[model samples]
Target: MVGKRQSRREAVSEHKRELILDAARQIFAEEGLDGASLRAIAVRAGYTPAALYFHFESKEAMYAEVLHASLESLGSAVDQAVSRTKTPQQKLKAAALSFFQFYAANPRDLDLGFYLFRGGMKPAGLGHDRDVRLNAALEAALRPIAEAAIALGAPQERANLLMVDCFAHAAGLLLLLHTGRIRMFGASAPDLMEAYVDERIAQLVQE
Candidate 1:
């Protein structure tokens, strides 16, 4: 009974932590990291600033946690989509579409992961480690597709380069769409992504 009570308490703590992270993500997206304060996040999370400190040691820690959570969720979505499909080509296409769909569906999360946090300027300690892990997650998500392209007769180096280019293009397109800088074709970003994936897959398969 004591163990059960402890577990329940831990669960509640985790739930509250998640609430803090989510609130911080929204605040970061809207106001940028430098602009979003611990006090603001506490208000957003319906907690006192002291309560916020209990979950996160500092604003940077909270930001790191938010970025980690976003990457984990995105990585999970890509992994699930990759696992659901059989063929390498299908997996690649599905992964690409899944990535685009994730960003489109969760623009706020994307802004936190890709926009709010400057890549090269990531803090030197835990923040840097979190950034590395996030990059690894992204690379893992793309590995299956890169393997597929190589299996389809493209040179390994070329296939890897192509995969990188495709990711950059898709990410850039999404950013443009989000900022109202460009209107993507079709009703949704995924629809445009599907067509892009189809074309790229065909090119890689032929090469």
Candidate 2:
């Protein structure tokens, strides 16, 4: 009976941790990192501040969790999209489009992932590993696309460089658009990203 009770308690604890994370995501999206406080997050999570600290040591820790979870989800989406395409060019385009679509669907997540650096929320520990793995996965997804483009009569080095450059540019552009720092084609951010990817892919294929 004691063992069963302990297992149930652990499950409850895990559920509360998830609740805190969900609440933190909502609070961070609504208030930004600097503006969101531990007290506010606790209230949002239906817990006392001390209860929140039981799961996360600090506001920074909670923020890190939110960012880590968001990025992991996005990375998985990119991986799935790339795996579905057979050709390198198609893979590249799919990866690009998948990334932009993620941001369009989760602007708050995009803001949390990319723009938080400017807000003084430096990620540490596992957060760093998450970022590195995410970037490497993206690069790996593009490699086949670059190789296929080269095999089809395109210049090898240029195709590889351009593919990396285009992916980086798209990520930066999404960040800028989300932060209201740039406008594109006078359309919604999603439309602008789609148009940009279309133009970029066309230029690459023609070259």
**Best model number under lDDT:** 1
| Tens digits of per-residue lDDT for model 2, 129-177 | 5556555654654565466556546687877876676567667777777
Which ranges of candidate 1 are over 4 A from the true structure?
1-5, 116-126, 184-192
Please give, for residues 1-207, the per-residue lDDT of candidate 1 as tens digits.
999999999999999999998899889888877778999999999999999877889888888777777777887888898889888788878777787778878887777766433545464434566667767877876676677777777788987886797688778778777887665443555566788889998877676
- Model 2 TM-score, all chains together: 0.72
Please state every model's RMSD to the true fold in angstroms. Answer: 3.5, 4.3
Looking at candidate 1, the ten consecutive residues that score lowest on lDDT are 116-125
List clashing residue pairs in candidate 1. Answer: none
Look at candidate 2 and give me any clashing residue pairs. 88-145
